[model samples]
Target: MPTTLRRSLLAVLATAFLGAAPSMAMAGVNPPTVDDNLDPGSSIHVTKTVSTPVIPPRPDVVLVVDSTGSMGPAIANVQSQLSTIVSSVKAAQADAQFAVADYKDVSDGASVFTVRSDLTGDPAAAQAAINAISAGGGGDGPEAQLNALWQIGAGGNRISFRPGSSRVVVWFGDASGHDPSLGHTLADAVTSLQGVSAKVVAINVAGGDGLNATGQATAVTSATGGQFFPSVAAGNLSQAILEGLTNLPVTVTAETACDPGLSVSFSLSLPRTVQSGSDLVLEETISVAPDARQGSTLTCTTRFKLNGADAGDEFVQRVAIGVNDVTPPTVACGPGVNPSGRTPGGWQQAGFFQMVADDNLAGVSVAIRDDATGTSFGPYAPGTYFKLTQAPGRSGSTAVPFTGAVDWHFGFRGDATLVATDAAGNTASATCSVPPAQK
Candidate 1:
């Protein structure tokens, strides 16, 4: 089977499972004590929420191509298609910036070569660089992919977008150079690149049997939330790159109410207008009052209207709703001293952290992470908080306790973010930071 066909099948299977599953219940699970749910207060008492489509920000791209003796034909093909790729990307997103890096053997070693430092919106420069590359190097040593990835991740001259732009590193190679042990080095480089919100896309040009190619692409892409195109050739490389650039769906959860018969509606706001061929999936939950029907069918439809045109904007999707009999859980957190400064024992000593996320239909789970180390902590134990009588006056709050004499010397150097996920995998996160202790 073709690689694209396999991916398509997998996606279809996943979607089929999601649709066939029973409508998730939001009640019975305990509500958090602090009412920390990020969405506006819920009245229908939905247990879970999840999103179907997620569009990411504009990306900065770095094109890394292999320039080996055997790659003469492939290299030439890539050079010819360079203009088309740039134009397509620009058409999709105007802010996209690009850079080129070609690797060939220099006097010092095989992997060493020249890198153009300037990044631009100009397609001419990219094309020029592509045309200038020569594929004649003696040492057939594997391409220095690890080193190149590291350099790109470290924000070398190849990637030059301003801060905050999404960064994407696209690596193209024809043969296996280094062993999988280089994965650690690749991962570290990717990690640094991610610090700037950049991801790595590996496109292996190795044809014939795709044994090592697939594995290499997977290693790099998995580490950076990017994609791997194994066995891709110069002919299909541009398309592969574009497909990889498209953002995947993001999960979102909102709280709203609906009567047994009345249709409840919600709208998804996009960061920008949706492109013509692009489509979005709308995932939702309609929770009924406690004494409502158990096996009712809830209908859902997605409408895309321009300027409030009812005719053009309406598209419908439906699902069967199932009732959950279990009682909702309650959530709670800290009665102890708040960590004013960095706790001497790091995050482990933050005390018993707890929160209750309840849904009359679906229920919820919460996760916490330390922003400084990018370390994730937990789905803290439940039942330490109180349920809202009628949607508490405020959102939610959670407390982290600091024990012993506060070490003013090592104050909080980073942020701790808390995220709550419902049964539907809908999530909301809140960030709190301990101020740096006085010197």
Candidate 2:
């Protein structure tokens, strides 16, 4: 099979084993598992990639309806479908919350813009507030829409939105808002909405000079990071609300945390904003401290956020690091000295020489190998290893060539290598040469 097709099939099979469809975005760390025999004072890097979801979740929606005389049917429709809308949003995001508010003309009474309910997770409370709204008095062609928005958005968060949530105002009406409604102009409304991070989904109902009758809906929605749906039927308001929430624009960013022994740095100057569903690649350099003990493990996690809200564990990537020792022990062999004399059996007597081995972490053994004779000698421990013993008057001046060792004649005729091994299996060697009995 082709490489791409095979990978796709593997992904499908893996998702199937998990008993779920691939409906949500996921994040991953490249080379997820790191096992290395690294020397002390060394480091490595890991790549973490995070992708944003298609929808911004944890919506905090506020229904800002125009409760004018002509808006009875629209108000009633929303009240009836409030439960369904809540269920749909909760299905997409379990932490969704809702609120209710309405606006009428200032000329009618002192209750021009009233917040019926604060933002809450209780759908029943929001529905009760919407049900209590009686569309009765709205004088003239325009209502106090701008005033209502100002109160909800810039009026000190009159709706009490959750910090880190996607703020939305589902506003609908059949009439345009009064310019400078209750001392607040269109520009003031837009600025206030943006300040509170609120996105307006303006649904202009049909059968009258709508909210966009004078194009104010278009201006407000565009300037506040929202959408404008003109001439929508009063009955189809619920579906439009659902569509608005799903299609809402969101910003993505990344954050990282690591264990004490490990330090991490990223390639991107976070929190860098990215579009929804876009791939964000971050090169994370994970370094183990130079003084970190061998045979230890380090870990780090990279998490994602959507519009400043935590995107949960599904959008997190974790890395595990293993540290091992790779430094070899040091080995040195003393110079050769000629044999003192020959034995009666015509065998050369043993000469003295020393082999020293040192390791950074201790616990080392020393061994010797005769290159010319292909013979091996003792793998002696620290104190038991051979050492040079000078005869009387045979000081450093008369230290001639030697036939070394007792059993296998190491460095007997040619050169020999002294090897040292540490407890971690790291090895080092040094050569020792003996002249052939000085001719």
Candidate 3:
């Protein structure tokens, strides 16, 4: 058979074997037989007991509703679903807290009324307040969505909660309330709600308006790192709100621990992936919990493979690891300056050198030098300014090389060194020449 056909058949056979392996294993093991005959009233009844895991407290939630006349249907629907909403919240978080805010006539003296304070672990009160909210007024002018959003997000009326508690803010509106025409941005509103780190969800209910309320809602949601539910009607409003609130935020923490010195081995557990690149991506936060050390140097040496073969010969990249408090080492290189030869009278010789270095904590430093006679030439900082001199070499005596094409037995040296001393004092060094200035 052809190579492609053979490979496909092998893959199919492997998949089939894998799919059947579990059933085959189970069939090989016989289950325990049960006794058919049992005593009647004389035998005691054995009950099967199950233990329930303790449920943690739920996150804090703030509901921002638009009470404009257009929201009557939505408000009524939300109130009707109050019981189910409260029950779902309670089921998910035994100690969840909830707050409600309503915005009316938002443009002119936009009214923001807080119907309830944070009702912690009190689902009954939250439901009562939800039932009490009435949608009225505020239909002619624009909805003061920016002001309402700002108040809930960063405004003084924002809800407060303990660390690790999820903070959620749901905004219900229709039509772009803020003035998108005059660049009345949501940035101010987004900036205001920074402290609580609240996730803002905007549910736009405006119908037949070309104002792009959905787009505006999405912008506000993305700004606060929240989700957007657009053009949802009153009937589906409660369900959408619950869906957005029920999602638990994924928390991640990263740590690194490894063997002490050269050839060090370390593992990291971050609450989430720290970096992503073309070759490899972090699947999840590396968790080194008990095994990994904190505030220590972790040297990671990953091997790249292509088709199960080492591809390190193709390309190699370095990844640096450092802790919060300590300052990491820096890399520095020597300059590449050309040496001076005899120039005819009234002629001057100019040489150029370049160096490169980098550091995670302390920064970088570079120095240039001439290798011919062990003498120090220059330690100029490496940058675009380090270019070859425009002057020609005395009309023919090896014409002082133009631009970057200068020759004079040069060596580029660099070292990874820092001011702060680390536990392992890990460092790196490299050296290379300018490849003999092209003939």
Candidate 4:
């Protein structure tokens, strides 16, 4: 984006980006991130990654807790912030499904170590469950955190993660958790979590457990490839948990490709970092050379950290450009006799032109060419040819006043060629030959 952007080579993207509006935002973005040294004769193939995982418009999240007596403040905080938190999460993931599973140490002996709520799309329902949870338990230092993880993380069927959904497990509490005693070790917890590929985001509420509690949470998350939050070691437990859930990581990629002679830019006006559920567009521009052939096709592709990342499924855009000038322009001529402005046929020499959007006709450009002698001339002068007024069919007519006769120079012939080209690389050409010999 901070490179020398050459504008002329990107004619193709002007139209293609407009056509692919659904897939991306029209922001300034560079597909290759850098574009100055690209080869002009080569096909363009640049990819730009978004770098942040788009928040799943609706993600499936399960809150597994270490609900013990000290958990009162943590659970209450969750209740107070539940609405705002869900609202914020829903802003990015409108269809976010939230469920809860509260667990105390198995040593707590039958006091509701594991309580599961079915996933619900309604934020209100999720908030209600969060508000209803109570922090009450008496046991050893460790809680049945892993067993709770086992039930849901192992796809225990009590909670179902939707298909094509991001799997997240958020757990918070004020104390440490035990690895064994529930008939399963820490490895068992890791294996269960692997079943669903759920990232276990652990929150050591209020720094109460000191190192041991955070250690257990860290071990589980590390085994599962989930991330551990900042080392601030303390904060509002509710804020910490929400931040872990909503501010997820991501990988983004954008690719802009084209045929030779066409320049493609993937990040014309695109953001380097995009948050989840943002309706932003990654703009791409493709320009073609003046001499590029007509009827050519072009493409743009973008891949993300997760496949199928485009909000509207607009991962790629392709189009065919039409070229003008398939045939030479037609030129009609009759030279005047003896250069006296008098034709033997009594008709003045002239040229006629037509093009698309006939009513919007602009005068055409023509230079004289002698086929036999290989010479070309003019940008003819005003009185040499006059444009027609209110012409028919987007047309223009002009008279060429020259020579006294059609064959003034005894068999000399002047073939006039007319060429017309349009904005989309379409060109038309025609040649009219003045007959040789006297007419």
lDDT of 2 by residue, 1-439 (tens): 2345434533442343234333333333344444444444667765656655444667789899888899888888788777777765665567888989989998978779888989888888878888889898998988999999988986646878887888888888999888898889988888889988888899988977889977889998888767888777887776666556655556656676877777667787577654344456777676778787765677777666777787677666676777666778888764323343222231222333456678877678987765555555667764332322323232221112234332223323335677888888999998765333544
Clashes of each: 38, 4, 22, 56
How good is model 4 by TM-score?
Answer: 0.57
Q: Regarding TM-score, does 3 or 4 come out ahead?
A: 4
Which scores better on lDDT, 2 or 4? 2
Q: For model 1, what is the error of residue 73's alpha carbon versus the real structure, in angstroms, after optimal superposition?
A: 1.6
From the highest TM-score down, the ranking of the candidates is: 2, 4, 3, 1
Worst 10 residues of 1 by lDDT: 25-34
What are the per-residue Cα lDDT tens digits for candidate 3 across 1-439?
2345334433432333224211111000011111121111111121211111111124567788877767788888788775566555555344567787777654435244454555355767777777767767765656666666666655555556555555678788665665531232467667766556776767776462512443667676666667776578777777677656533232223222334321222222222311111112232111222333434444433332221222222222223333332333444333443334322232212223334444443433443332332234333333312322221222211112233333332222321111222233433333333232335
lDDT at residue 184 of model 4 (Cα atoms) = 67
Global lDDT of each model? 0.48, 0.69, 0.45, 0.51
Error of 4 at 352 (Å): 24
Worst 10 residues of 4 by lDDT: 1-10
Cα deviation of 281, candidate 4, in Å:
14
Tens digit of per-residue lDDT, candidate 1, span 208-289: 2331443655776776667777677666666566556553322122232333542434334322233222333332334334
TM-score per candidate, in order? 0.45, 0.72, 0.45, 0.57
